[model samples]
Target: MTPHQAEQVSFDNTELDKFAAYRSDGATPDAPDILDLSNNELMLPPLPAVAESLHRSGLRVNLYPDPAARFLKANLARHFGAEPAETVVGPGSGGVLQQLLLVLAGRGDEVLYAWPGFDAYPLLVAVTGATGVPVPLTATGEHDLPELLGRVTSRTRAVILCSPHNPTGRRIPRDTLREFLAALPPRVAAIVDQAYMEFDEEEDPHDLGLIREYPNVVLLRTFSKAYGLAGLRVGYAFASAEIALRARKTVIPFSVTHSGEQAAVTSLAQGEELARRLAHVRRLRADLHADLGAQGLTPIPSSANFVWLPLGGESDRFAEAALRAGVLVRSYSGDGVRISVGTEEAHRRVLIAAKEFLSV
Candidate 1:
């Protein structure tokens, strides 16, 4: 075998395959092309105000950005009711997560989290040379807080809690979260990844209140979803001032581009517009679930902007069928296909394709 082939064998082959496969082949209509639900990016672009700010910033090619991202952090803190020193902005929340893994984990350290959750947690922990301990979720696709708490050990450095979780789209309720945190070991860091919190229909979807009381809890938020700033890649984290400092050290200065920061800050000031967009997506997601049910495909209840269809290997078949009908959806084998709640047109296309797939 070639050296390159040997290197490829060292990683999770499933991830390698998923990463390598494109939803569509440019020249072929046989490949999926109509809808892209694979990467979880919001279908809409940022508001004109945000777009205008980026356009006016021009090229800051020669200057180093504010190393501490003070102004941007301050704006975010003010919006979230947190202190400026308690928050740190990163190019994207994913990048921030990478930094957290680097700083808090090392060889022989075990990182605890729930499985069928974010695909990145284990991958990131492994990259940092730490062991990953995944506590399985309940049958309803909810994180089992008791199981997770039981697995925490002296060697466990951190845990990642993904609410409005990926793939499954179920959320961990506030009362459940409080119980879990109360049970967690003080030394173990708990990272709350609220990537899809904006789309949550539930009241009080976040746990910012816990940050005020638990120095160990770090809350992660991003602009990629409801804010529609995915292209600019902006996100931030909030923790106790001391923990925030350690997390900040993992990322180098100017890592967050000036344009991205400006766009995010502008979006924050734009206010209720984002909440309006999320409400629309939430409504559409519910409508799509009913549509899928009408066609005999069970779509798991979702709190995020997408729905999960439980179909194992048939997920690949479902995705292929979707492509045949000129629509694309995200595939998860151990569970099913995840269709993004996009335009009304896209949602209708998925419904038609799903009906056709089920009939056959």
Candidate 2:
């Protein structure tokens, strides 16, 4: 075969194109109009102070960002009580995940993660030429530990755990995570992706205590969620100093820009105010859950900023109606619809749209 033919053949089987294929079709305008709920981004930008800082810090456009992303890493460490040396920041949580996968797993290896979890997990595994072992959640929509434990093999190099899992919004309890970590072979690393931890009111959040005990455990977080910095694209991971240092080395230098780093640090510094804003989102999420239930739509109990509506037969239809209503909600044909909790007015608009769909 000619070189061109081989290149064409290689592109055809590229697994990174999973969701990449779905990106072409943009959301319809008539949809829910509630794009505000996307990954915890507020319709409004940060407060004036943050905005002004961005404005004045102008045109460092000529210079590259700090290679280590020191300021953002320091702020995240201070905010989360992690050791500064144990933290590393990336362009976003997705970037951090990609870095982790690249560093830990390679071709012929196995990666264990929960199913109906993050859409990116399986795709990333496939791109790496690694086997993606997806253990489905239980009926209640919680990650099933026994089944996951059963899937582990000597080839399993790592496990990815997302608490307050995307799509489902069900968090893996701390004790459960500890148990899973303990059961895994010492050679295998467990990556805890806490993208929605800020929305969780759980008394004892997913334990970072394990990091001190297990050199293989890594905690991943993102400013994209509660910090309302999704557009700025900053995320981080915490692990033992050794693992964190290794992960940092794999990161492309200056992957995070100047604005992204500053925004993340500013967001962390606005802690109390940010917490209040997150609480509002939680309240709205609760209200949306109740409103949808009243509309005869069964929604999964959400601990995140978004709620899941299990539209067994009409998932697509309902999503279509939402789009028609000028609101944008995520729809998975075989799964359910994940709606972000927007402002109160926006939430009411979505409820109206959802009600109309249910009536039909």
Candidate 3:
């Protein structure tokens, strides 16, 4: 084909417009007076030991990271009590999730997940050339398991379940999840998105026995939220050896940076420090929930480090009010607004704006 033909091919723009680009709160401009709680990022600095590890790793910028992130994989295997072959590491949970989808799904396949959950799910599934089938959450903002299972067909490649679900903040109880898994078809893989599992202080976050029970399960996790390593972007997953191997084959080489890998390794060693941060986040979440309730708003109780208000048509209005108060929060259009558990000043600002909005 001639160069002119190649340029003309780009003119079609058919597949290019299949979906919208993935947007994130990280794009919000940083300002001295602004408190951006739009993104569910830990507002605290990195832990002492984690900070030191990153500092040392920074000195070797001239070298390339381990393409497969062998050390990080080994550490994760030990931390989560799995064999190295059972692990898949990538730049972030989203990145790792994409890796899994690239292997498990493709053109003509359908991936099912809850709507008003992760904004990126459909976009991520689209990248694999698969259609994203959204199962709407219940009126109470919880997943309807039977409804989801009923949507599955012979072409269904995977079903994603997010516990401590995003934006809505409701978690799937272990027994409930186990029951769902039991009913799911054997050929279909179940990807359990556990990005916020660390903030779930009331349950056993370290449990890996679920994978043993369901070999098709893929537990996706990240160092972003509670570990304060969002900037570094280290994520991993635990799956059966066969599934993990396929996911690993899809990993983008060197996507996990050296500094990110080391920081994750160091963070894994500080269980006590991690616990302290988790407890602090839980306190902030509860306080924020109660405070919002006091303002006559119904904020869903969260197992994650954020509170979700199902404002219906007021979602955008409430988010606008928060921005006017110099606090940025996420608005899911007519669904709700998600306010990350930020510092005291941020929450204070949110409360004032909320009360002001209610009074009007």
Candidate 4:
């Protein structure tokens, strides 16, 4: 008799295969000295207060963290002027988003997001057993809200909007976003991913009136980008109490480590430090933009901590040149490249690479 063949595994294998793991072209060992402008990480070290908190929390690593992340959640709630029940904390914004997707969508459900947006959006949506519907961004790297609104179907359970959109760094204007949210069907949830909101030119980053105005809107934020806690991996979301409760239930217990919680809470209290850091990053971004423009590369105006070069078919070439110049920048193959604002030295290397590439 023939050896028994194992039965085929169940679930959507095709869908899983179609999705790719999130990729970031960060520095490699071969280029140990390379200036990494690939990942949009804060170029500066963690805040002094946050560092102190981390050191204190490090001593308690043996103990399990609060599963509910109560302290962090409470701080986040107070910061946003929302009740504790309205906030859900997770390992990072990506982790929080995953929980949200699990709670709001499932097999045969559709999740809509802009293309060339956050690299993780599609992957997370796929993991939830939901179909990921991507709407292409406009030529100027702005979300085509009309196209997005038009694509909505009855099966569309959630829409993910990235302000100061990843890669492109284009923000949807407040009025435009308000109109879009108002027009969206009340049954469909809207997730505004604001990981880079702090870097935006807005005076008040902690404002949460949008949630009150639109019950279906959920705001996602991360300490990784602005707070320089990428290593600790802390993020949170604010939404209606009902939605937050569901999302909170889906979070993996103790996913937000004790150190992360303590650090994030401490970081939240350092508003002046945060403002200074934001101002510095904005200055660097502006300088980088001017340098790129002077080199004849018209990078899109960015409110976030990175710049987008819509190289179209030549994106890989520019990335390659940057790498050769000992600078690591993110490339989207045929679409564009995103270079994070880094130190003056890193920006100098990027500028040299840009000049060389443009000349060729």
lDDT (10s digit) by residue, model 2, range 1-360:
988877753464344554464234645444343344434456556756567656655568689889888988887787778888888788788888888888888878999988777777887777677778888877777888788888889899998888888878898887777888888888998998889888989933335687888899988888787877777788899888988877888788888988888877776667678768877788788888998888777899978878987775677787777766666777767777788878776677677778889787
The deviation in Å at residue 330 for candidate 3 is 0.2
Best by TM-score: 4
Q: lDDT for model 2, on a 0 to 1 scale?
A: 0.78
Root-mean-square deviation of each candidate, in angstroms? 4.7, 2.9, 2.0, 1.7
The global C-alpha lDDT for each of the candidates, from Candidate 1 onward, is 0.80, 0.78, 0.90, 0.90
Ranking by TM-score: 4, 3, 2, 1
Please identify model 1 stretches exceeding 4 Å from their true place.
Answer: 1-33, 203-207
Better of 2 and 3 by TM-score: 3
Error of 4 at 360 (Å): 0.9
Residues 1-360, candidate 3: write the lDDT tens digits: 988877753443333257678883333735679899988999999999998998899999899999999999999998878999999999899999999999999888899999898888988898888888999999888998999999999999999999889978889999999999999988899999999988886567569988999998999999998898999989999999999999999989989999999999999999999889898989988999999999899988888999999999998899878877889999899899999999999999999889878988
The ten-residue window of minimal lDDT in model 3 covers 8-17
Candidate 4 differs from the real structure by a C-alpha RMSD in angstroms, to one decimal, of 1.7
Q: Per-residue lDDT for 240 in model 4? A: 97
Q: Is candidate 1 or candidate 3 better by lDDT?
A: 3
The list of candidate 4 runs beyond 4 A from truth reads 1-8, 11-13, 24-29
Superior by TM-score: candidate 2 or candidate 4: 4
